[model samples]
Target: MLNTSEHPWKLVGPWYRPSSLGGYAVTKTALNRFSAPIIQKYADANFANNLVNEPQHSLRFNSEDFVQPFSGDPNQVITPIERAQSHTPLKLYLNTHSRFYVVVCELHCDVAGFPQVERNKVCEAGFVVRRRVPVITPELKGKVETLLQQRSQLQNDLNKVNMQVKTAQLQESQQSSDISGLLKTKSARLFSGLQSGTAEKLTEKLQDTNGQLDQLSQSGDIKIELQGWKSSDLKGVGNWLPIEETPEQITEQVIPMYPLIADPTNPNHSANGKTLWFGVIPTSLADVDSNNNPRFDDADLYEIRCFVRRHHSQFPIQKNHTDCCGDVIWSEATEGYQIAAHFDLDGTSHRPVNIKLPDLPAIRNQVNNAPAGRGASARIIAPAESSLNFATDSMDMPQGGEPLTRAGQQICFFSIFLFFIVAMFLFRLFLPILLFIFNLWFLLKLKFCIPPSFQFDAGLVGSLNFDGSFGADFNASIDAHVELMTEFTADLAVQVAIEGPDLEAKFNQPNFSITVNKGKDNEKTYVDEGVLANDLGLMIANGINASDDMRADIKNGGDSPGLSSLSLNELAGIFIAMQTEYQDVKHPELAGILPTPDSGLVYFEKVELNKEAA
Candidate 1:
C-alpha cells in the first residue's frame, strides 16, 4: 500500500489573486529562499573556503557559473548582466541548499458546457528531490583490487601456454612433412622390387612414426586441461545483486488545492494561471523515524523528481473533420498532458519535451499487401506435325477410255505376269547379298563401339592345331581288297534249237497248250553239334548275373528305407561325410587358377578365405 498524504509544498490560487496574498505568500517565501543573490553568496563563500583549505586542488563549479572567481582573481565579482549574456539567467551552486528545489504550475478549465472567457490560473504546484549516494566502502575497494590482480596473473599464464602451443604446432608440421616424404619413399620401394626384410622394417618404422603423430594430435587439444580455470573462481562472482531499496522508490503523490475542489457557486469553473510552489523535500527518507518525520541533518536532499499535469482540450478532433462545436470543454481527466522533470541537488535537470509516436498505418499496409503488385503471364503453343498437300489439277488423266482388244488384253496380261515373275526372281537372287551387307554393317558397328576402361583378358596364349585327315593307308587297303574280290558269271546254251523246231506243233483251238516244266533240286544239310556245344559253353562261361533288388523294388513302387532305421552314431557319420564332401568341393584349391569364378558369386567366399589365411 502507498501513503497518499498531501505533499507539504503544494500550493494553489486563482488568477485574480495578488502575488503577495493567500497561497502566493508561501510562493514568495520559497522564491526568496533560492533567489540569485542568495545562491551567489553561497557559491562565493564555498569557493573562497575551498581555496584556503585545499589550494592544491582545483575548484569546480556548474556550467551556469559564467565567471569562475577561483580561476581568475579570487576577489573579483561577476555582475548579473554578464551572467544573463552568457545564457545563464540564474547562477547557482550545486552544493547550495536552494539547488534541490523546483516550481511547477498547472491550469484547469471546464470542458463540458458552453464557451466562456476565463483567466489562466494555477491549479496546483509542488517540489521534489532525487539524488545518488556512494555505496562503495574501503573494504570493497581492497577486494576489487585483489580481484583485478588475479585476473592479470591468469592472463599472463594463458599467454605463456599459448606460446608453447604454437611451438608444438610448428614441430607437428615438420613431422607431417617428414611423414609425407617417408610415404613417398615407401611407395617407390614397394613398386621397385624392394626386399621383404627392408619393406617389413620400413613398415614398422612407419607405424612408430604414426604413433608419434597421434600423440602430437592429442597433445594439441589443451581445452580439456584448461577445464580447471572457471570464471566463478574469480572474486565477487555470483548471482546478480538485487536492486537496493531506497526512499526515492516512492510513487508520485498529488495533492489537490482549493481551486481543484468543487464549490457550489463556482461549480466546475477554474481560472488558469501559473503559481510557484517550493519546499525542501528529502531525496532519501532513510533517516525518517516511525512517526513519518525526517531528520534534516541526516536526510538526503540532493535530487528531486517533479511530475506536473495540466488540462487540455478533452474532445479529440474527429478524423477527417475539424469542428469543436464552438465551445470549450474540460473534464477531470487525470490522463491529461503530463511532463516529468528530474532535478538533481547538483544544479542540473533532465526534462524530456520531444516525443515521437509510431507510424502504424504505413506498417500495417506494408504487411497486409507486400506482394500485391507482382504478376506473371505465360503462353503455350502445341507442336504441329509436318504435312504435305498435293494439288491434283496438274495431273493429266482421261475421264473415259476405250476397251482393249482381246489380243491386246492377252498381251497385257502376259506382260504383267512376266514382269511379276522376273521381279520375284531378281528379289530372290539379291536377298542374300542384301542380308550379308546388313550383317557386315552391324558387325562393323560393334567393332567401333566405345569400350570401358576394364576388359577381360580373353586373348589366347598359344595357337591351336586340329588334325582332320583320315588314315590314307587304311583307305587304300580297303580299295585294294575290293579290287581283288571275284565277280559272278552266268552262261546260257542254244544247241537244240533246230532239232526242237521240227518237233514243235501249234494248236489252234483257243490257243490251248500244255507246258511241262522239269526242275532238279539238290540240297545238302550238315549239323555241327560239337561246334555249337563249344559256342554255348563259351557264352555261358562269359555271361554275368548281377542284380540290385532294392533298386528293382523301388522302381516297382516300393517305399525306400528311411534314415530313422539307422543308429544315432550312423547318422552322425553320414552327416560328417556330407560336411566333408561339401568342404572338399568349396575348398580354395578347387577354385581353379583364378580366386573368383567366372560368375563372380564366389568373390565373397574367396575374400573370406583370404582373410582366414592372413
Candidate 2:
C-alpha cells in the first residue's frame, strides 16, 4: 500500500486500470498543482446558485475559468446553493461523471528508474449516490399500523368468501348429477318400445323433472347481499362531480395521493407554503354508461357530503370559504376541478403530515350481517305434475310421485348385485396376464439394449533371427466382450489368442481356452481347439438358466501352473526340454546362460515392481 498520508488524492469512478490496481493514488502536491485550484474557483463562483440554479445579484461570475482544456462544459450554471460556503481545505469528493479531473501523477515506472505522469488529460470523474440513514416519525408509524390492520381484515374476508364458493361448487355438482340421472331414466322410457299411453306418461314425467331441476339450479346460485355502509352514508363534504369515462381511461388519468416529507436541513429545499390539490371524486363513481348519459355524478356529490359529516368539525376555516368545509376549497383553475388545502409556508418544516379523504367505512354491524356462507336465502319450488293442477298435490314426492313397488325394488337390488359379481370375475381373470406381459417386455428391453465393447490386437509380423543368435517371435490377439448381468453390475470377458512355431512344447495349453475365472476364485478353464464348439454350447445354456442375482464361482484347487515358483536355472531346464520337443530347433545351447537358484536371481514376473506395474 502506498503511504496515504503523503499521497492523499484518490481517483474513483470509471477510469482505466492499466495494471489491475485497486485505484489511482496521486500525491497531494500533484493535485494542488493541477485540479485543486480549478475546482475551487468553480465552486466559489457558483456558491450563490440555489436548487433552482438562479444567478445571484451579490456574487461576481467569471465565465473564462469554467472552460477546460479539451471537453466543453455542458451545464451553464456555476454552482448550486446546496454546496454551502466552504472555508476548510478543498477535498473534492465528487459524483460519477460530474466533471473531469486531470492530474500530473506517476502512473508507471520505466527500467531506467524514471516515472511517467499523465498531463492535462480529459478524464471523466463520477461519484456514487448512497441512501441516507432511515428516519421514522410518529405520523409514519401510525399510518403503517392502520395499513397493516386493513390488509389483515381484507385477507380474512377473502379467505371466507373462497371457502364458501368451494363448498357451494361441490354441492352443486352432486345435485346436478342426481337430477340428470333421474331425467335420463325418464327419457329412456319415453323413447323405448312401448304402448302409446305408456310413452306419453313417461314424456310428461320427464318434463316435470326438468322443471324441478331448473328450480334447484337457480337455488344453488351464489347471490351475495352486501349491507356495508358506502361513502354516501356520510354527511357534508362537497358537491363532488364524477367525470364520465371508461374505467381504463380513468385509471390512466388519475394520480394516487401521496404525503410530502419536508426536509429541514435546507430551508430552500422545502415546498412549504402551497395549496395541495386532489380530485374531489373517488374513482369508483367515475364512468360512462352505454347510452352515453353521465353516471355517478349525483352519487359522488352525496359521497362527499357523507365525508364532511364525519370530519367537518376538524376542518380549519379559510377566509371567505363557507359553502362546505373551509379546509377544502373548490378551485376550477386546478386540474380536474380539484379541492385544495393551504399548507404552512415555513421553509424549516421537516415532518410527515396527514390529509384525510372519503373512503369506505368499517362498521361491524353492517359487515357481520352481510350474506356469507351458502349465499343469500332462496326458495326452491317443486315441479307441477300438470299446468291445470292448483291444489291437492304432494310437494315432496319420491320418484315423481311414482314410488316403486316391493317386487320392483327387490328385482333392482338383485340385478345390481349380479352386475358387480360379473365385473369382479372378469377383472381377476385378466390382471395376471397383463402383469406377465409387462414383466416380459421389461426383460427383453434389458437384453437387447446392453452396450457393446470394442477390442484391439497387436503382435509381431514374423519370426526374425538376431545377430549370431536364434530368436523366435509370436503373434497375439486381444478381444473383449462386455455384458450387463444385473441392474447395476456388468461382466467383462477377455480372450488372448497367441500363436508361435513352438507353442505346444512350452505352455502345454490348447489353441483356445474359455478361462471364466477373474481375480477372485483363481480358477482357469482350458479348452482344446477340437472341443471349443461343445464348451461354448454348455456356457450359453448355463447363462440362460442364470437369474438376475446370479454370479460366477470358478475356484481353482492349485496355484497358477506352479511356473512362478521355478528358478531361472530350472526354467532353462524346461526350455531345454521344449527344444527336444521341437523337430528343427535353433539355439539349443541358449539354456547354458541361465543362473542357478543359489545365485538369488529372479525374473520380472517375480519382482514386486513388475506386479505393481501390471
Candidate 3:
C-alpha cells in the first residue's frame, strides 16, 4: 500500500553536502540550527567555524526557503549543484542508481522530492522513534528558588551601601565650602585691622575652624560583602528526575523503531556498506529517580531526532594504454602523471572529476586503527550513546568571556580611581615648589643701580660714583655767609670760598673783636692783633667739612695774616691751638671732635637733595 502521509524528517543537525572538491560544504540552514538566541544580535552567517573543513558563505536566515522541498528533476527546477549553492536542498542524488535498504520509515516532505521509486527507497531504509520523557524534582526546584532570592537580597544591600557612600561625600563637600567661606571672611578682617594681640587671637580661631573642617571632610569607605555561592549547596539538586517504567507499561505502548545501520544497497549508505546513526536523548528522559529501586525501572528514556549525512569526493581517473592493465608510469619531467592505473580490468579507468565514491567510514576506521605503542597511552573507547548536544554559543568563545561580576567591576573602578588620586596629590605637593623657583628667577632678572650724592643745609647734590670711593679729581665746593657782630665785640665779618680737588677754601676775617672792662664800670672794645684765632673753631666742632682739607686749612690760617686761604685741615689745626691758648679764655673748647687728618670725606646725600640719588 502506498502511504501518502506527511514526511517525518526533522532537522536536528547541521545541513552538510558533498562538494565537487574533496571536503564537505556546510550551508546556512545547517549553521543556523546550531546558533542560539544569545548570539542572534550578531549578523546571520555561517558562524560555525571549520564545520566541514571548507569556507562558507554568510547568508540570510531564511527558514522559509530552506525548508521548502526542491524538485528532484534537475531539468524542471534548478540543478542540484546550483540549488545547493543558493540553499541546502534536503534531497540530493549522486548521479547513479543502487539497490539500497528497505524499512518502514517516517520521511518528512522537505527531505526529498525524488520520484516515487527513489522516495520509497529512502523511506524503506530510514525510521523514527519516540521515548518516555523525564520530569524535574520538587527538592531541586526549591533549592534554585532559595539561591535566587539570596542573590537578589545581596544586590539590594550593595545598592544601599553605595547610596550611603554618596550621601557622605555630598555632606563633606558642603562642609568644606562653608569652612572655606568662613576662613576667607575672617582672614580679611584680621589682616585689615591687624594688631599684635589681635593676630594671635585670630590665628587660634582659624586653627579651630580648620580642625573642624578636617573632621567634617573625612568620609567612611564603602565595602561590599557578598556571600559567594558554592557548588556544595547544589550537590543533590539534579537537572532532571524521571519516574519508573515497567514491563507492563512497555507492552501497552506502541514505540517507534529507529534504524542505526543502513543497508549497502541504498545510495545514501556509506561505501563500507554501513550507515552510522546519531541522535540526542534529552536530560529529562535520562534523569534517574533516586528513591526508586536498584533495577532503575523508574527511569524514562527521551528521543532526539538527528539527520544523517555523507561526505563525498571526486577525482579524475584514466586508463593505462600500455600492455600492462593496472600499471602506472611516473615521469620526472611531467611532475603529475603520464598514465593512471585502472581499478577495473574490464572497464576503462576514465571517470569524471566530479564523480566520487564515499570513503568516510574507511577513514574513520583508519583513525581508530592508529597504533598505541611508542608512549601513546590514549585509546578511543566507543561511547555507549553516539548522540551529543553541544553548546554552540560557547564553541568559539573562551572561558570567563562573559561580563564581569559586580564586585570585580567595582575593584577595577577603585584601582583606576586610586591611580588618579595619587597623580593629583603629587601635582599638588610639587606645584608650590615649582612656582617659587620661577618667581625667584624672575626677581633675579630685575637688577637696580644707585649713584652717590652730597647733601647740604640749603639743598643736596650727589656724585656719579655710587661705590662711595672718590678719585683725586672728584670735586666738592661750598660757600657760607656769616653776620659780622655775632662772634666779635668789634665790627667783624668772615666769608669762605672753597675750591680744588683737595678742596682748599680761603677764609678771610676783616677784623676780630675783644671786650675789656676798664676800671670797674667803663668797658672799651678794640681789634686784637695777637692772632685771629678760633675764627673757624665753631665750624670744625660741628663736623661740617670733616675731611683732611678742613684740618689743613685750619692749621695754616691760625696766625698773622688777618685773612688767608685755608682748608678743612688748616681750620682743625687753628681750633686745636685756640683751645690750648683759650684754656683761660672762655670760648671754644676742644674735645678732639674735629675730623682726624687721615679721615676721608664723609658725604651724605638725600633723595630730596639729589634727584639722581634714587
lDDT for 390 in candidate 3 is 30
Tens digits of lDDT, candidate 3, 88-188? 22211111111011111122223333111112223212112223331224544464445435544433333333333343333334433575445434433
Clashes of 2: 14
Tens-digit lDDT string for candidate 2 (446-540): 22211221111121111111121111222221111111121001111222111111222213332323343334222334454323222222232
Q: Which ten-residue region of model 3 has the weakest summed lDDT?
A: 330-339
Candidate 3 deviation (Cα RMSD): 52.1
**Candidate 1 local lDDT, residue 472:** 37
* Cα lDDT, all candidates: 0.25, 0.24, 0.25
Global CA lDDT of candidate 1, please? 0.25
TM-scores, all candidates, are 0.16, 0.12, 0.12
Ranking by TM-score: 1, 3, 2
**What tens-digit string does per-residue lDDT give for candidate 1 at 132-204?**
2233345455644454355444333333333333433333344335754454344333322322344355445
